[model samples]
Target: MTTAPVRSRWEEQRSFDELGRPLRDVTFCVVDLETTGGSVGDGDRITEIGAVKVRGGEVIGEFQTLVNPDTAIPAFIAVLTGITNGMVADAPPISSALPAFLEFARGSVLVAHNAGFDVGFLRHFAREQDLPWPDFEVVDTVKLARRVVTRDEAPNHKLSSLARVFRSGTTPNHRALADARATVDVLHGLMERLGSLGVHTLEELQTYSSKVAAAQRRKRHLADRLPHAPGVYLFCDDQSRVLYVGTSKDLRKRVRSYFTASETRSRIGEMVRLASSVTGIECATPLEAEVRELRLIAEHKPSYNRRSRFPEKVTFVKLTREPWPRLSLVKRVLDDDADYLGPFSSRSAAESCLAALHETFPIRQCSDKFGRHPSRSACVLAELGRCLSPCDGSVDSSTYAAVVRQLRDALLRHPDDVVELVNAKMAALAEQERFEEAGVHRDRLASFVRAAARTQRLTSLTRCPEVVATRRDDGGRWCVHVIRHGRLAAAGVIPSGVDARSYVEQLRVSAETVVPSIGPIPAATAEESERILRWLELPGIRLVEVDGEWTCPVRGAGRPHPSTATS
Candidate 1:
């Protein structure tokens, strides 16, 4: 009996591995296009296309096709390319030639002398023709030459100059096939020079040719240990303190990019400079990677992580459980029966929502807690008719409770009442030409509705004790997620032929035991739950099992209120 190969938790066989495919293993389709004009936006059309597919310095195949431009070829263009309208009249149209070219060039890095002109025309044509453009890795021979050959070796990095400098066997002319052939030679020549500089892999060559700073490029070794899988990465300083935290589908590619020009953020550059090492935590799925990143960032509070590090600072608008209930902004949610409407991003946002609630309800605004039988004097808000003055028994407990019930309904069950009230108030203000005051009410109403919607959305998921879902990824594997009380407890992937339901149960058994906590986000941070909710809502996600009813309120703040829809 044959034993299966054991896979490490931190390792997975990826099509594109950590070290990247060596230059010899990379297949390149050196392509050239003869166009009617320089700009696709100027209604340019491809007259001819030529491509030479090469691997390990050997030409495997060649593609050459004349395309009918469907218009008159300019006399100057005809003179340049040695092809006339007559020559292409019998040739295939771009609709045929383009697809054939794409099929031939598929799964190979595209190369061209002036890549912008050649690739741009092809991309524009594909888009205009409603063709799905493949994400092809492109290499420009001119760019490679500019990096490899100096001014002493070549005056300019143009195709003709590089062709002469490299002593290419094929001479570049205006024709597509000949120029494509010459670019192939130029590409190989540049690769040879790059190899001397220790750039043997496709990834290294691309980075070395890019505008990435030398200092940053030297730090590429830090990503060598990372696996090419979905996960979180922590950039730690010499003291082992995490300086930054991030996540990506491919850990090696993402972490390696920080040392390239692609990572342009100034703060991130400084963080990368200070980083002494990188620690990768590979996860089973992208969702798990994201959740892990969030948890780690919150735990470490890495200085370079600008967001998701201070979920504790998120504020919630609460309905205090006092004799005279009032809307108050609080940081944490407890198991108390008092209603809540937040996890708002800021105190000001929660306050604005509270203002909107007070505007619509005659609830007490006093910060002081009142006894059931109060002897204290009423506050200024009571005198202004904004409060029911429960402090002085101006409103009885039952009557005040009824108002609070309506407020809670507006916040949790239905926001129609609040929406109508705020809209009417704003409309009245606008009628008096008080546009600024109307705008203020509008902003307040927006804040209130947004918080209500967000809270309802979160609560819908958190209320469920357990949820197991699966979605088929592009790779034909079932990505399973085990969630408990809104937190991602566990995640895994099931092979195409395996029973997803059985795998889901296995994942559930191994999932983190999350205890239900108070508030909308029961086990995870509001941000983490929100991300999970979004993933759950995406099309094609199948619920394997749900322990409780997973639902949102019909008329709750989850739906857009008509009055605040535009706002």
Candidate 2:
């Protein structure tokens, strides 16, 4: 059996030979319509239709027609359009006129001054006639003029004003045919001006004429080299320093959007302005793209990225490996055989989990390093019956060890004792009408339970030496992932007809080697591990193989605490 060649991590970027339908090869149908009134829904009807189809600066064909409204045309509209009801009384009705006009404009890009008014009427007519409207790409000359011509160049973007400005042979006098002919000249004039700015394709013309900033619109060429596939993209400055990193299901589409008006974020605008180029790494699946984006952001620490740059700064609640074990908040996890319950976002969160553990177990809360033969006095916590008081010799080492064992169980395997103890305290406070204090206990309990749950969820995958999973994506391609100690060791997409199991095994063999580190998330960052766990938990994920235990504790703090649910 011949196996498919393994795809490299970085595929050669596909060249965009033709950005999108070069303008010289495009056929444009410049259309104009005279209506009986302002709105089609207000009983208004089309009075006349005129369109000119042109390609390569030459007129190919023309369509002209007058439609009988079946209703009386208002006197003002008839005067404005110079088409009285008497003129169209013997003409064909819209049902006939619209079909002929649509046939003439078929397979051509539509252009009109104030396209909404003209296209809306046409769309309404099509709907009323139960005719399926062809998805035509429309270009509004009014919007295009706004982007290109300034007030000094043209007092107003009126059809007559622009016709005079562009030196059109025909003048717009509210007549459909003459106005459409005038618009054809104006389109060519605008295209000539845009040609110098590199707007040579139909897509580039559409993007250039949008409400985007000219600086951003000029940079649309940066996306021309990107592929239309799921991947990670980086915006870099002249020095090649990454300005921003992002993931997209379609790299070309997403990168092009940065230059369009839809991207409204101010910092993104600044980033785009400073970016000298765009680099894309095409991935086989969306999951791989997302993971690559996270890893890139962490590696580059791009200035414009607001998250995932400081994974090392995350705090962890550690069960210190000392003569008397106690929970301590630390920044780094070491090779010591002490249990850890976090990867909290803040030190306060780690402290909350530590406080909850101290409240439940009478373990030492002090940070003093104790020798084997310690001779020290207990603090005020001992007097309040809060501490086990091993320092004062009030509690034997064995008895205190038992309490530490239960605390370790709460942090690692079972947290029901912590949950129950905290809930009872909250209930007692609420019964005594001390609701405010109860709220405090409720918050701490919630923090502890959530941290415990997150720790267990990550550890369930991190402890496993290898795990392979697969899921069929919306495109019917199987997305396979090989995870080693909770890190994404390998990922690839298997085509629908191929054997997914065999491909997944091949991926596992070539997977990245990961040496398990010491904490709950041994091989990857907490956020990365969480993302992997979420993908694993998503519906339709089939576990192909597992090298070690891959399960969460049955009675662990993986479930929501009662206090958390209510609060």
lDDT digits (tens) for residues 1-567 of candidate 2: 112243532355443434457788899999999998899888899999999999999999999999998999899998888999899999999999988889899999999999999999999999999888987999888888887889998899998888888999998999899999999999999899888866677876776665577787778789877877788999999999999999998788789878854456888888999999999988777777888888899999999999999888888888888887777888887878878888898888888777888899988888888765667888999999889887877887788889988888888888999899999999999999999999888888888999989989888899999888889888666788888898888888786577766777778778888999786765988888888888999999999999999999888888655776534
Q: What is the TM-score of each predicted model, taking all chains together?
A: 0.85, 0.70
For each candidate in the order shown, give its overall lDDT on alpha carbons: 0.85, 0.85
* Cα lDDT tens digits for candidate 1, 1-567: 011121344444533344667888899999999989888899989999999999999999999999999999999999888989999999999999999999999999999887989999999889988999989998887777777789998888888888998899999888899999998889888888887766778887777767777787788888887887778999999999999999998788889878854566888988988999999987777888888889899999999998987888888888878777888888888889888888888988888888899989998877876589988888899899999998898999999999999998988888888889999999999999999998888888899989888888888889899998889877666788888898888888875566756766767777788899886656888889999988999999998889999887888887766557444
Error of 1 at 402 (Å): 1.3
- Supply every candidate's count of residue pairs whose N, Cα or C atoms clash at under 3 angstroms: 0, 0
What ranges in model 1 sit over 4 Å off? 1-18, 42-45, 65-107, 127-132, 334-336, 368-385, 389-394, 425-439, 460-482, 491-513, 519-521, 538-549, 563-567
Error of 1 at 347 (Å): 1.2
Best by TM-score: 1
RMSD of model 1 against the true structure: 4.4
- Report per-prediction Cα RMSD to one decimal: 4.4, 7.1
Quickly count the clashes in candidate 2: 0
Residue 314 lDDT in model 1?
83
